[model samples]
Target: MSNEHFSLQAEIAELENILRTIPEEKAISRLSFESRLEEARSRLAELGEPVVKEKLQLTFRGQPVDGTSGILADFGGKAVEVFSSAVSTVMASINGDIGERGPVAKKDADKLMITGTAVGSFGFELEVAGNSNPLFEEDDVTAGGVVEIIQDLLETAATGTDDEITEVVDVIHPRALKKVSEFLGFLESQKASCGISFKGKSFKFSNNSQLSNAALKLKDQNVKERPVEFEGKFVGFLPHSRMFEFSIRETGEIIKGKIGSKKIDIEQLSDNFLKAPVGVTLNSVSVGEGKPKYTLTSASDIRAKAGGGSQPPLTQE
Candidate 1:
């Protein structure tokens, strides 16, 4: 057996032993015990099973479906269960619940299926169903498709075209529309809070609060800019102004970086005066005026290279 399989077996054995030894007085929560046991069994099931790694594509009414597509590890060779779980997770994330949605049909060990109507906020109703080949050996599997349907629905509610949103609402059950609507509003609010806008999409902020605030102020205007993050070298530091210069490794773009007033010490970095490679998270870039002005929000993971040389002074276009 593989090391991963052996490790899973050992873990299962340990969990089983613990379950057996629990005192009756302390085992007040049978539900908790059962939950842990179920989790252990699921892991055990995953050990020897062939997993789905390719992106799952599902077509609805001739058009390709759009949703989150990626590997789903080991699905226990059960299509319906996998689909149900995937749908439930996506729905629950937006506070929408899936009520009474199964009886998952297992057509032999290779295929499992489910077909039903689902209700969401605002009395919206949609047909929730699809089939897939559970056996990894099979060339056909709609498990991803089934999951994609629900995912696409959520995505539509989150950030889809007006037509897409209307179509999704028509199918969503009334009970779930409120939650989905709220979720959509939440996404919109998040985008607005970012302050930088381009092509109807808002820029996302990095973890650094100081830099993020500076970026927000710099890009608050009605200019178009692309947000990007990359690693670069800290080639110069202006101690008086507390500004630094960075040469982006990938694009060779030299950026004049300034720390927030509250973050003046950022230019000091470390004593090492050599080439300092740092990760730069730019909030936005405006290229309409002269040279592109890159609004940097954060710099981290600074590492020193062997050699160092003086970089040319930054010039305005």
Candidate 2:
């Protein structure tokens, strides 16, 4: 989507938040925000995108909360961290941060606004600042998509069977799944239950200890990692994605993986290593069922062997 659309969507969401949360007694402030919201909605309509009306609610109960009145400050802060991190990781995964290289930069992405508070339980109502006109399609990386996954994750944690949990996690990005584990850890520690309400549906898990066991089951026991040294022909590398391709000398098969090291000059890799013979040290991580993922740790120009031996190492972990 265009930057204009993105900015306008964010503005609309912010104005709606102000209008929703501002007290009725502050009529002047509410009026101004309402006017702005209307203008934003008009422009969005002119652009052919409809304004989004749905909002997601997160409610907390048990030890950390006191009905709809209040909550412990520290506990609340930790919840925010866990929730935000979970959302951010899922968003990143959706935006193509699948490899182990690193997390995608989320600074430009829309922020979740605290539009209002929920009754009957101490919680907050949330909406993404620019998500009303999501840039991505459904079940993808858009704000709506992220929230849906979060809802599924929470619901699974609460009532899903072990096999169901495994099935649900099979499609989730591992980094995002790690965040899910962290959230379960928080819930387990506080002995609290969380409820996610969206699209007129709600899911909550009250048994904290059971949720903790779910977290353990979420970890993939079949996954393993080992360090190895090998010779390969550097095929290509994309610095932006931190993805690389190498042709194994022993097998002539090409493999792709993320390049995570910072010490190596990425520019040099592109300029000198393309299709060149190189000896590389890497961490091979395997998930048992799929091809192993290689993380380059160090590399040396094997082409230099013609002169005498390998050149000075090109990278150091």
Candidate 3:
């Protein structure tokens, strides 16, 4: 295990070296580091991020959403992405406590040590937004914002006689609090109501007659045709095609993917190309196993701290 850990560390250092070779001037784009960082994090997680996550109490505008579950979705398998602003960066060195009577080589190997940790929290605000139906006739009240919706409903219930907005908050907030509970239950219900489907289906990996013919000659009666376009952030090699052209985003993310002059939504691509090596940039992640500690990486971006303290306070803003 120790050897494997060292090997992985060496691999990361090598990757860093490769990235450094890319000219600094060329890699100065604001999105470059983020994109690359996401990619690295994704790959590392796949190889084993060695990081951890903890279930967080969810809330929105001080109103307890009732239920919430957070997954290191990018790192683990769950997906309840919360905006984490409170990140604490730490660096420490531990001295060798076990003294040795032998030569200095043993001491040298165990001596000076430096390690850094990025800790932050990922929080979710439970607020729902909906667009007014175009077919419906316009009404004086709107159900767009959560607070507004609550206010509108309360006003109607009281016939505009009593104040329900503030009262509702004051009453429900303590009862539910900010921590959302029963997250997986909600997800299960959603799954039952709305089937989870990826958009990028029926993608052909190759167009060569040999490859295409092989696919056409599938023997698996239950096998379904895959529909996903394997693509890249910066460049994509046409495994088998005449020519390819597309505007590449400077951030190495993506503007749009054009296949034979047809635009495609990247989200659709992501869904279709699930399990394709993806990169992710995290503000922070928890450590330890189930009840882990969280460390922040993109502290500034996560919190938008303005030279004040560490990060922004956790509040639905």
TM-score of decoy 3: 0.13
The candidate scoring highest on lDDT is: 2
**Candidate 1 at residue 190, lDDT?**
30
Judged by whole-model lDDT over C-alpha atoms, candidate 1 comes out at 0.39
Candidate 3 vs. truth: CA RMSD?
Answer: 29.9
Relative to the unseen true structure, what is the C-alpha lDDT of residue 301 in candidate 1, on a scale of 0 to 100? 29
Which candidate leads in TM-score? 2
For model 2, residues 1-317, the per-residue Cα lDDT tens digits are 55778999999988877777889899987887888889988997788754454577888888889888998889887887788788877777656555665754574343567778876689888876345454544434566567777788667655666545544554455677778778877877898878888877787766666666666655556434567766767788887876788888899888876665455666667666576666767766653344566776544423432322334435535
Error of 2 at 7 (Å): 17
Deviation in Å, model 2, residue 28 alpha carbon = 39
55 Cα displacement, candidate 2 (Å): 1.4
lDDT of 3 by residue, 1-317 (tens): 23554565666676676666676666465346546655655665555423121222222111122223332333221223211100000000011111123221111111111121111222332222123323212321111222232223222222321223222222221112111112222332233110111121111112123222222222122112222222222133232331222222234433222221112233333333222332222211111111211111211212221332332223211
Sorted by lDDT (best first), the order is 2, 1, 3
lDDT of each: 0.39, 0.68, 0.25
Q: How many steric clashes does model 2 contain?
A: 0
RMSD each, Å? 19.6, 11.8, 29.9
